[model samples]
Target: MVFWVPILSYAAVILLTAVAVLRAPAPRPPHLAANALLRYLNLFPVGLMGLWGALGHIVFPARSAAAIGWATSPFQTEVGAANLGIGLAGVVAAFYPNWGFRAGVAVVTAGFLGGAAITHVVEIAETGNLAAGNAGPILYTDVLTPLLLLILLALTYRSARGPAA
Candidate 1:
């Protein structure tokens, strides 16, 4: 369940956003799909997922550690704090929707998740830790979510710029 939360959250958000965007009225403004997707991604996967992670790591440290195939430690609290910060940033980005603010949030989120992906990889290589949290959907999401956000960011930027000269 620990591993599934991130995966399911991401999937649910993406899928629902796609459906919503598709069903919206026609004569849509520029970048409607991209903008909607970016908003939903920030609000749900990045925002809520990070908060959930914080909750697990801080409020349920032992379970969080075991899921990751690690011993519980003081570091979990620190990690949880980081998660809270990033998660709040994501939520704010969703509401604000300014290009720079959203971009900054996306970049910061990418760094955090990218670092996590590396650590997961290292744990797998050096320690052979294949626990669900270490080797499951979370690992993939950590890598892909950032990539998707960046792609959407770029697309939105181009859309905002209008067609090339």
Candidate 2:
């Protein structure tokens, strides 16, 4: 139960975002009505998760520091920048449903996931433990979350654009 809670919660966020994005009322209007509502409802939770993960990295230094290589370490700085960029992308995607917005989300999502994957590899090399205790949470937040978001983004893009484009 303890280990499963975060996984379930993250899944719920992704599921809800997918539902909202798929069901969004036709994107027609002054761009300030239902579209705004849909965007916020879909993207806000994911953004908050990213923001929370970033804050956790700072506030729970003992736990998160090792995963990123310490708060001030170069690796940590890169992770922080990636997280911030992804968080902002989520916010922007909430308000814009264009191809550009989708591309930004995809790019940020890849950056975040790639950074986490690299960090995990580095940790494994340094410590000889794949499941470094402190690293699990970071993997859940950075790797799993972005992967889920990327899937959601792809689904949304496919549904919105159809098969041709």
Candidate 3:
């Protein structure tokens, strides 16, 4: 049940936004709906991860520490703080119509996730930390989510620019 919550949260956000896109002004360009959807979707992971970390650190330190085989300490709090800051920055980027803002935040967030995936790979290789919590869905999502965001960004940029550009 706990496991399903995160997955459901993501799906809910996406599904709700899809509904909004579909119901948007019909006269707009075909890509407009998709672009708007992607713009909102870009913030999902950051917000989810941010709140997850912060809550884990503050209220559920035991479970959080167990997940990564770490002790409950101030480090978890620091991690929580960083996650919230990064996530909030993503929220700020969500408002801009300019690709520059979107791209900047997307790249940084993706880079963070990319780095996390690498760390997980290293932990698996070096320490054989096969704990489901350590090298499970999240590790892969770290890579896949960012890639999806990048693809969305590319599609949105190209859509905005047109083929002639």
Candidate 4:
């Protein structure tokens, strides 16, 4: 149950984001400009998180330790970057209701999902272990983060499309 809770939560977030995005409006020049600026700034943190994750995997060589250590490493940095990107995109979308915001969300979400998937697969192949009996950070970073991002994207989209605020 504990293991599944995060998974379910992530799924819910994704569903919500998808609905929101679909309801959003077309891109506007002003919104696009703002989102573009935010996107550029957000990339820095996201890159850091990714780097941390990669480094953790490389240095620790232990799934659980690698996952936990990632918090202080490049992985966390990347996650922070992505969080900023998504968050800014959400805010911009709410204000602008445009395609640029939606696209930003999509791009960042994809990065999270893509990286997590790749890492999980590689870990499984090399270590022949999946979460190593659920005492590892791998599940949180590799599975939970992507799942939540997907949900957040969906919600952001929905909010963008909903009645303008």
By TM-score, the best candidate is 1
Give the alpha carbon lDDT tens digit for every residue of 1-165 in model 2.
Answer: 213434655566556655665666777333233343335433643465555555654455445554444434445555555556666767677667775576667566667566756767687778665443335554555565556545655546544665596
Q: Considering summed lDDT, which 10 consecutive residues are worst modelled in model 2?
A: 28-37
Runs in model 1 lying further than 4 Å from the true structure: 161-165
Ranking by TM-score: 1, 3, 2, 4
Q: Which stretches of candidate 3 lie over 4 Å from their true place?
A: 159-165
Rate residue 19 of model 4 by lDDT. Answer: 54
Query: What local distance difference test score does each model get?
Result: 0.88, 0.55, 0.69, 0.46
Q: What TM-score quantifies how close candidate 4 is to the native fold? A: 0.39
The residue-by-residue lDDT of candidate 4 on 2-49, one tens digit each, is 244334444444454455445557664333333333332223223334
Is candidate 1 or 2 superior in TM-score? 1
Models 1 onward score TM values of: 0.91, 0.57, 0.78, 0.39
Clashes by residue pair, model 2: none
Error of 1 at 7 (Å): 2.3
Q: Write one digit per residue (lDDT tens) for candidate 1, span 1-165.
A: 876787778777778778978788997766888888898888877898889889989999999999999999999999999899888988898888898898999899999999999999999999999999998988988998799899999989976566781
The better candidate by lDDT, 3 or 4, is 3
lDDT, residue 32, candidate 1: 86
Residues 9-104 of candidate 3 have per-residue lDDT tens digits of 468658867887777877767667556656565556665565665677667877877776556787777767766776776666556567777777
- Two-way lDDT contest, 1 vs 2, winner: 1
